[model samples]
Target: MFKQKKQQELREICKSRGVSLTPQRQAVMRALAARRDHPTADQLYEDLCRQMPGMSRTTVYRVLETFEKLGLVRKVDSRASKAHYDADTTLHPHLVCLNCGKVVDYQDREFGHLEPPVFTDDGFQIVDYAVTLVGFCRQCRQDPNN
Candidate 1:
């Protein structure tokens, strides 16, 4: 969860984007930001429903998509059947557990040793690329190995 100051800053961002700080949207953002577990839209909605009564599952899903476009959040890649919401904006790779399907962050000096590959675009610009590293988390390696 972000500090009060960061929450206020997020609110300001919404205002500047001309996006209303509706109760539903606010609740959804708060829930996602409060958690680092990288929850799916449905999971997020379940949490929001408890805090903000009458919150629609669809609203939670749509609001998240809007915030993603506004750069307030990101979709964390996972082996799970659904997408996950991530508030961290730092550039880093992820290690996905095959057994429990957990997502772990990874940053290595080796990654910095090589320059990123580049390709010319016909017209559109390429801003950036995310490097996702897939592997088993320590928790998944315990006991019987899969």
Candidate 2:
């Protein structure tokens, strides 16, 4: 969807969730959707501030957490300490670059078919999962010059 439509939908989502749709929240979503870097709250705050010179870091982090809680975005933690937000909310997996830490979504039937073994064995609820394939991207794998 276009930014205007997506922004309107995001506003509606926030309203439904009882979150006040302040311009800071709107700008956070816009900054995320505008790029594919999987930026953190700090990165978002920097960008948001460039446009909205008065935006706060705390608000950016809070809005992103709110978005995740509403299922408007996916939160992936490729490691223990950091969380990455994904805009595409669908059945998919991740191809993560170990060198630069870029995450790209990879969707396939093979991945879709793998049910959580624990669900059947121990009767645990399986909501969703990200089947990760970690490796270096082409740019990271290639030498700068021949």
Candidate 3:
């Protein structure tokens, strides 16, 4: 039920933005929406390749780029070298595991209430922001070796 509603919302958003909702685009959106792990383009490509055998890695990259530009997705920076994509565009925090390279969503009212620092003195206009807390995850903490 949620997926269907999201699909409709996506279609409406695309229409408003004059973006074409191609089959490939929809497939990519669904793939991102289905996972909250903030997967990289290659990860998404790998998963979709089994179903879309002919889909190229370049196409996946391009689709994700388009989605990011359309504000349908967010490109999150992680400890990993590659950038990860998030389908949820809402303003929220992320908990990144330094050891396992895992990314998890984090929500804190106090953090959300904090105001953005003033940077106008430096001629920087803060349009938006995101907070990411980095630390060891439960699995890593349990391992004595780590």
Candidate 4:
């Protein structure tokens, strides 16, 4: 379950941002906030299908995109082709299980403070980034079937 305080904060942020807190969007937000596993838009739609029978895949994708734009969610970097959504937008790293496509949050203060590598000839501006460590998760590592 999502923390009550966090949910209230989200509601207030939505109100301040002038984003309509529609039922579908609210449901999606709750779903995202409740889980640590970074889920794709399709996964969220499937999870909410019973509760939001009328909701469409397009709506879920749009709402996630909007939330990402508003800084309410983070679009996690993944090896998988599908985009993953994270409600905890704080700067942190992620552990991606290649076998099962699971994403778990990893927070290390030291890691957050590490400076990026210097770029010279490329002249590319270094911005913010989320570190992703990819490997098999416990379940996958334990089960050869995976």
Q: What digit string (tens of lDDT, one per residue) describes model 3 on residues 1-146? A: 54565577679888999888888888888887888789999999988898888889999999999888878889886768888999888887888988878888875746755677667788898877878889999999999356
**Considering lDDT, which of the candidate structures 1 and 3 is the better prediction for this target?**
3
Clashes of 1: 0
83, model 4: CA deviation in Å? 1.1
Scored against the true structure, residue 120 in model 4 reaches a CA lDDT of 45
> What TM-score would every model get versus the actual structure?
0.80, 0.80, 0.85, 0.81
Q: Candidate 2: where are CA atoms >4 Å away? A: 107-119, 144-146
Q: Candidate 2, after superposition: displacement of residue 76 in Å?
A: 2.3
Model 2's C-alpha root-mean-square deviation from the true structure amounts to: 3.1
Candidate 1, TM-score vs. the true structure? 0.80
Pairs of colliding residues, candidate 2: none
Predictions in order: lDDT: 0.74, 0.74, 0.84, 0.83
- Candidate 3 wrong stretches, greater than 4 Å: 109-113, 117-123, 144-146
Worst 10 residues of 2 by lDDT: 109-118
State the displacement of the C-alpha of residue 71, model 1, in Å, after optimal TM-score superposition: 0.7
lDDT of 4 by residue, 34-71 (tens): 77788999999989887888989999999999888888
Clashes of 3: 0
